[model samples]
Target: MRIATGGIAQETNTFQREPTTLADFERPGFGVVARGEEILDLEGTGTVYGGVVAEAKALGVELVPTTYGGVMPGGRVARSAFDTLRDEILVALRAALPVDGVLLVLHGAMALEDHDDGEGLLLDAVRDLVGPDVPIVAPLDLHTNLSDAMMAGADAFVGYKEYPHVDMPRTGARALQILAATVRGQARPVMAHARLPLIAPNQSMVTTWQSPLKIAIDRAREIEREPGVLAATVLGGFPFADVPFAGVATIVVTDDDPPLARRLADELATICWDRRAEFAVRPVPVDDAIAEAMAAPPGSVYVLADIADSGASGTAGDGTVILAGLIAAGARSAAVAQIMDREAVAACIAAGVGSTVTLAIGGRHDNLHGPPVRVTGAVRSIHEGGFALAGPMGAGTRSSRGRTVVLEIGGPGGIEVQLTEVRGHPHDLNYFRAFGIEPTERRILVLKSAAHFRAAFEPIATKVIEVDAPGISSANLANFDYRALRRPIHPLDAGARWSPGA
Candidate 1:
């Protein structure tokens, strides 16, 4: 069987000031094509293609590759950019005519200026091109804002089960398996979608231990074991997106079992509503968090999350709330990865390693979080920061820190600070290794992220504490001056109650 594969993935934040452009796609890498006669080793952050190639090799299926484009999460996608990608994929599908099936990896929460349901629009266009008979399987992020149109257009859909998205390979495998089955005439797939009323807070929606998500995931696994059920997905919709379908969703794929799928989806949605309250998170004050961290044991590492400036939520990742707290607390042996300042990086490079120079770090993009903190520190190490993942997420994925420089600051009260220019989150151990800063050796490690840090840091941390810092994706829903979000959603609308059919 010949299978066609491609992807266009990005989680758009409508409120972000910058729009995702064609340049952004090309800058981060864009469009890889690998066909049947080629045996290329797909590595690095090329996760979608990596999994697709792996699955095709295992199944002994001939593969036809198309263009794949992805960008970091940011503002609404430009209309022209969306058109370029959509047209490219549609053209590829038409070119690869009579193909057995199509597999796509999509970030299901994409919002374009002209289209709110970007994934659905792509799927519909593909369905129109391929005709109704061809099986189309898609793997999506768990944070997708699933739409009814998407459910109607695709034959089968699966989403990452883990929030940190450690399950990308598994989701890809499932999509391929379903597609293979459909190609072999072994199964006929139908999809059902359930929209939940509640909107989960980004911080509280961590799937590692939180309720609603935990229960919902467990129930989904249980239902997947039932006959006729091919896949079950619970999408914790992207809250930052202002689209109409912005909320939690439960989707099930089965073979001619619409009734059973609907019943199971409703059951899952009911559980989501029941556990809605548990997903509400109260932010801890930056000063309080610092005090707590400072007072903790010597070996303990405190994780202070500046959620609002979280790179995952389309912020600039330059917030200074936690940095200010650290400065005020006069804590020692603390390390913060990636403040994303070009000027600071240049100065550090010019000054050379071990040179004591005064520099301003953070607060350049977001004034709402706090002003930048001025500190005099020695340039600890300057390197062209590069590291390969040592964990589950593309173990061989190589990421650059973009001319990184680490500044070690000595405060008035003997605190040590390591500031970097890398904008990526402190999600992996490699992030530290890239800078020659060993996290295991530090007394305190501060990461500007929501949750992904747990997978790498949890094992070595004597104790992990999540400090709520200010930025765009804050735990406090009221902090954002939201103009477009639908009313009566959780936390924002305290008295809202939702039933399955309501």
Candidate 2:
């Protein structure tokens, strides 16, 4: 069997002020824009492409690698960037025609500046090109924003069941298996999508623990084990996206059983809705979180999650709210994984290591996150912000945060800040270890991540506290002015209610 694979993946946050451009997608060490044979480089990585390549090799199928562009979650994609990516994928697919099936590796929450449904549009175009006979399948992120167009364009979609998304390769393999079965005439796949009027915070969507989202994911897994069930998944959805479809979704795929798929999808969706209130989160204030950490066992390490400024959730990783609090309290033995500030990094680089420099760091990206905090510190070290993931999530995948510099505020054993020239997701310990900072030795580690960091940092952390810092990606939905989001969403509006087929 011959199968073609590739697509664009990006999680969009409509609340962010900056627009994601082609440059962002093409940024080396950060963004990915692989084409043809270059896609084979992901064969052993823990990514969707890696899974697709592995599965195809195991199945003895001829896999055609096409264009695949992806970047970290950020502001709504620019129309020109989206068009370029979409066109590249289409062109590659056109060249790889006469294939048995197409496997798309997509982040289903992608929103463009001019269109709310970027994934849907791409899927629709692919479907149009493949006609109806050729099977089209995709593996989606757990934060997918299900849309009617997306549903209409694909034969089946397998969403990542885990929130930290350690199962990207697994989801890709599962989706590919379904497509292979269809191509071999072993199964007739039918899928159903159920959208719930709820947008839960990222902190509440962790699947590693016994959370509400975890319960729904467990139920989805159970349903997948039943007869005729091909795949099932519960998406917590990306609330930062202000699109109409920004809410939780349940997707079910069955072997020629549309009714069963719909029933199971609706059942899972209802389960999430019933536990909606449990998904709401109230992060502790920055000062209180720091105090709590200080009160802990003397040598134990604590991970203070700065969720609001999570680059993984599309905020510019430059919020200084927590930094301000730490500095104000003269917090010692604390290391901030990162604060994205090009100007600060440049100043530190020019100052040279060991030189004392006073500058304003962070809060230059967006007005919604926090203002810059001025501080005088010695330039500790400077290095290129690039590292390979050594964690469960996206392990083996290379990541970068551009130019980086370490600044020690208030002298030795004080708060050490890692300032970067580009935004970053410090989910892995390698992000810190690469800079000569040992996370285990730190008393408190401030990270600009929501939950993905838990995959690597949780086991080492004595305690994890989500800090209530000001940023666009925070649980505080009220901070964002939504103009296109559907009204009466749960948690947003306590009175919001829903029923199947409503």
Candidate 3:
């Protein structure tokens, strides 16, 4: 049997003003595009492709690799960029005709300038080419904004159960394994989908032990063990996307058991919806968070989670609310992971290392994040901004922020700030280590990340505090001016209600 695989994956934040262009995908660090045989290089990696390749080999199936393009989560993808990626995948799949099945690696929340359901449309086109008889299975990020077109175009979906997405490869393996079974005539997978009028903030949806999301995920896992059940997935959905279908969703796939699938899907959806109030959590006030960090003992590290400016959720990574707070409090032994300011980076680069430069930093991308703050600091170092992931999440993958310039805020060992030309995820320790900052030695670390940081930072942190700030990815959904999202959503509309058939 032959299984064709590959996809274009991205998680879009519609509130971000910048458009994700073709150049973004072509970039070396944060973006990746693998075609045909080149895709085999991902065989033993931690990505979804790695899982698919390993499973195919074990199942003794010919793996037909198509085109796969994945860029960092950001604003709506430009129409031209989306078309180019989709065409590449379609062209490759067309050449590898008569495949037994297809396994797709997709970030189900991807959106484009002209399309709200990017994965749905891609699946539709692939379904059209492959026909109904060929089973198509996909593994989605846990934050998928499940859409009807997605359900209609694919036979089955398996979403990552972990929030930090540490289980990406496992999710991929499950998807391919299920597809292999269906293609071998051992099982017929039927899927049922249920979407709720609920939008949980990314911070509140962390699947850390006993988290509210974990409770629902555990129940889904329980159902998956039932007879005839193939898989169960619960997607908390990406609220920042501002799409019509931006909410929580559940999918249940069973072997020729439509009734069972629908029952399990509805059960899981209701379980999540019933506990929706728990997901409406508020972060600690910025002042309190800063004060707590300042008071922490000098030996250990304290983490301030700047959720609103989270790069993982598609913010510009230039929010200065927390930075301003830290500076105002005259906090020592503190470090801000990053602030995306091309002008500031350029100025620092021009000033050269060891030279002092005064410039306004951050708050240039979106007004909601806060205005820029002026700072005079010596340029500690300049780097090309490339680093390999040393953590469990995407361990073998490489990432870059494009020309990082470090600035010592007060003095040599005072508050250090990493200013970059591009947005960055400081979830991993290597992000700071690569730029000459030792996370373990620092008393306080300010990170522009929601929950993903916990996977790497929590282990070493004395205390992790979530700080409330203003930005597009803020947990306070009311702050956003969302016009495209479907009305009567929870939290936004207190009267919003949902039932199995409603």
Candidate 4:
């Protein structure tokens, strides 16, 4: 049996001003440029494609890779860019017709300039071409905005349980294995979905350990191992997408048993909605977080999570609120990865290493986060800006920060500020390690991330605090002017309540 597989993935943050283009996908970050059998090179490496190849090899099925290209989470994709990627996948799949099954690696929250339900549209087109007899299984990211069109088109779905998504390869293996079984007539997978009217912040959704989301996901896994159950998935959903389906979702698949699927899906759905309050947490105020960080004991690494300026959520990554507070409070032994200031980095490069350079750091993108501050510092190091993920999330992928530099500001174990040409978040500690900076050596490690950083920085950190700085991706959802999101949603609409709608 041959299973066609490939996907175009992007998390569209409508609140972000920048527009994700085809050129962005060709950049050194997240974009993997391989097509057809050339994609087989990813077999033994890290990624969903690697798992697909491994599973197919073991299952004795030919894994026909159509194409795979995904960019970092960013603004709404241009319609032209979306069609180019989607059409390429479609054309490849058409050429590899008469496949027994199909497996897709998709991020469910994507949106285009013209199509709000980007994945839904893609799935609908694929379903039309393949027909209903061909079972389709899609592995989705944990932060997905699952829609009705997705449930209608795909036969089964699986999503990452961990927020950092360390289980990506495992999730891909599971999807392909399930499809392999279904194709061999050993299993008949039937799926049921339940969409909760709750949308919560991503800060508390880490599934590596016990939390509200973990509790529910753990319970779902327990039920998934039952005799008739095939798989269970809970998506916390991406709220910044400003789509109608931007809320919590649950999907349960069973071996030819719709009732079992429905029952398990409802059970997990109730668990998520029951702990709605826990998911709607508020970030600690910036000033409060700063004071606490300043007063921390020596030899401690406090991970100050700057959620607002998180480049992972498509923010420009040049916000100055947290850095300004840290400097003003006379905090020492601090290191921050990155405030994306192209001009600042260029000036430092021209000034040469060890030269005292006076430049305005951060806040260069927009006024949402605060204006730039003049910082007089010596250039510590400069690198061309490329690193591999030694972290839990996307661990083996090669990533780029684009012409990065380290500048020493303030005095006494001075603040090391990493500046980048691109607006990429310091999700992994390797970003600092690439420049010979040790993160554990610093008293305060400031990361521009919401929760993804915890996977890497948590091990070395003495404490972790989320800051409510003003920006597009702030933990405080009220900060955004959301126009398309369905109202009466949790947190955004505090008094809102929900249950499975008939």
Candidate 5:
């Protein structure tokens, strides 16, 4: 059987000011470079296509290559850019016709300049090409903003079980398995979808906790053991994407069991509704978080997360709220990662290791988060920051910090700060290992992420704390003047009530 695989993954924040262009997708050492004309072959690296290639090789399936492009999460993708890439992929699929199956590694929450449902449109186009009989399997991020149109087009769907997405390769393998099973006539896939009324805040959706996500996901898994069930998925829909369908969703694929699938989906949705209040996270102010971290017992590492400027949701990781508070509180032995400052990185490189230099860090690109914080620190080390992730979210994928330099700032016991040009979030142990810094060795680890950090860093953290730092992807969704989002959704319209199965 011949299989075709590619990716066009980016979570669009409608309120963001920047446009995700082809150049944004080609960030040096961070994203892939694929133009419309390129027939890129699969090369095993830390990319989506790389993971696809690895899985196809293991399964011994003949693989068809196609262009894969991904930009860091940001504003809407340009209409022309999305059209160009979409047409390129469709043309490739047409050229590679008669393939047994097509597999897509999609972000599932992509928004275009003109359309809110880019993933749905892409799937519809593919369905038009392949006709109804052909099996189309897609592995998606757990934070997918699933739509009814998307569910109608694909044969089956699988999503990352872990939020930090350490399960990319695993999710890919599962998709392949479902395709193999379907081709072998072992199962006939039918999809069922349920849209929950409650939209989870980005920070409160952490899977590590015993919230409704844990219970709902557990129930889904349990129900999957029933007769004719093929796959079960819980989509913690990307709330930042301002589309009408932007909320929590549950999807189930079963073999000739539509009723059972719908029942399962309803069960999961009910669980989400019942636990909606538990999903609300009240973020602590930056000053309070810093004060608590400073007062922690010696040798304990406290984790402070900047939820607003989280790289997971595609916000520029340049918030100054946490940094300002840390400096004000005179916190010591603390470290932050990938501040996304190009000029500061250059200065640190020129100053050389151990040379004292003063520069502004963070808050340059995203003024919405606050002004930049100035710091005087000695350059610790310079390296081409690259490492292979080995955790659940980014396992087996290669990532880079891109011309990274560690700076040691004011602290009696020596506090280190990591700076980089790359704009992606740190999802695994390797994010720290790339800089030769041991996360477990630090007394305080400040990550610019919402929830994905918990999967990889929770094991090492003595205590984890969420800080209300400023950025585009703020947990206080009400702060965003969302003109595009439909009203009467969750906290936005508190007085309005929504019922399940409406």
Candidate 6:
């Protein structure tokens, strides 16, 4: 049996300042943009693409090559770039005709310039090319925004079960397993969805495997043990995407049973919604959080999570509200993981390490994440940033910070800020250790991530306090002027109500 696979993946934040372009995908820093059997090289690793390879090889099936392009989290993908990659995947699939099945790897929450339903649009195009007979299965990010059109196009969908998404490879493996079963005429997979009017804040969507989400996922797993059920997926939609389909969703795939799939999906979605309040979060104000960090006990580190400027959520990593507050409160033994400002890094490099410099770092991108704070500091160190991941979040993966500088702000504040040439989320401790700074030894470690940092920094943190700073990915969705989201959604609209469609 032969299976064709490859795709373009990106989680679009419509509000982000920078436009996602073709160049971004070609050199994504962390991973290479692959083509042809080049996709085979990505297999059997920790990534989702690797899992797809594992399954095909295990089944001893021929895996056809297709192009794959992915970009980091940012604004709506430029139509030209989207077209270039979309056409590449479609054309490749068209040329690979006569395959037994197809496996698509996509970030389900993607939004292109004209089409907000990116995965749905891509799936529709693939379906049209392949016709109705070819069994198509895809594994999606847990942060997928489910759409009706997407459901119409694909035979089944496999969504990641973990946040920080350690389960990517397993999800991909599962997708191929189903595709193989279908090819052998063993299991007829029928997919159904129970959509919810919920856009959960990233902070509340933690799957320590013990939250309300855990209860729903556990029940779904239990149901998967049933004879007819194939898979059940609960996706916490990305709120940064201002689209009608952007909301929490439950997808269930059953073997030759539509009614059972719908029923299980409905049950899973209801359980998640009933515990919706547990997902609501109120962040501590920046000034207060800074003050608390200052007063923290000796030998303790306060993990200050500045989620508003979360690089993972497609926000510029130049937020200064928390840093400004820390300076005003005269902080000590503090270090902020990163501020992405190429200009600032260049200025520091020009000044040279160990030289005293008066610099205004950050706030160059936009006004949403606060203005650049003026600090007179000495350049502590400089490096061409590259680090290897330790685990939980992209374990064993390599990430780059580009050209980086550590600024040791003078005076009583004693704040150290890391400035990078590029904007990448600080999900792992490598962001700090790679630059010669010890994260655990610091008094206050400011992380520009939501829940992902918890994978590495949580265990050692005396207390983790989320700060409600200013940025595109703010926890308070009400802060943004939303134009495209469907009216009266949860948390946004207090009286919002929803029931699954029949």
Residues 149-240, model 5: lDDT tens digits: 88888999987666666567667778878887787788888888888755777776666876667678878778778888888888888877
Deviation in Å, model 1, residue 149 alpha carbon? 2.5
Candidate 3 Cα errors over 4 Å, as ranges: none
| TM-score, every prediction | 0.93, 0.99, 0.98, 0.97, 0.91, 0.96
lDDT of each residue in 214-320, candidate 3, tens digit only: 88899999998999999999998999988899989999999999999999999998888889888886899999998888887669699999998889888989999
User: Candidate 2, which segments miss by more than 4 Å at Cα?
Assistant: none
Writing each residue's lDDT as its tens digit, candidate 2 over 1-502 gives: 9899889899998888789989998998678999889998888788887788898889888889888999989988999998888888888889888889999889999999989999999999998898999999999999889999999999999999887888888888888899999999999999988898898888888987888999989998899999999999899899898899898999999999989998999999989989988997899998899998887888899999999999999988999999999998878899998999999999999999999999999999878779999999999999988788878977778888999999999999999999998888888999899998999999999999988899899999999999999988898877678878888887877678899876
Minimal lDDT window, size 10, model 5: 36-45
Clashing pairs in 3: none
lDDT of candidate 1?
0.75
- What 10-residue stretch in candidate 1 is worst by lDDT? 28-37
TM-score, structure 1 vs. true: 0.93
- Cα-based lDDT for every prediction: 0.75, 0.90, 0.90, 0.84, 0.77, 0.85
Model 6 TM-score relative to the real fold: 0.96
lDDT of 5: 0.77
Q: Ranking under lDDT, best-scoring first?
A: 2, 3, 6, 4, 5, 1
For model 6 the local lDDT of residue 152 reads 92
- How far out, in Å, is residue 24 in model 1? 2.2
Which candidate, 3 or 4, would have the higher TM-score against the true structure? 3
Q: List runs of model 1 lying over 4 Å from the truth.
A: 28-40, 43-46, 411-422
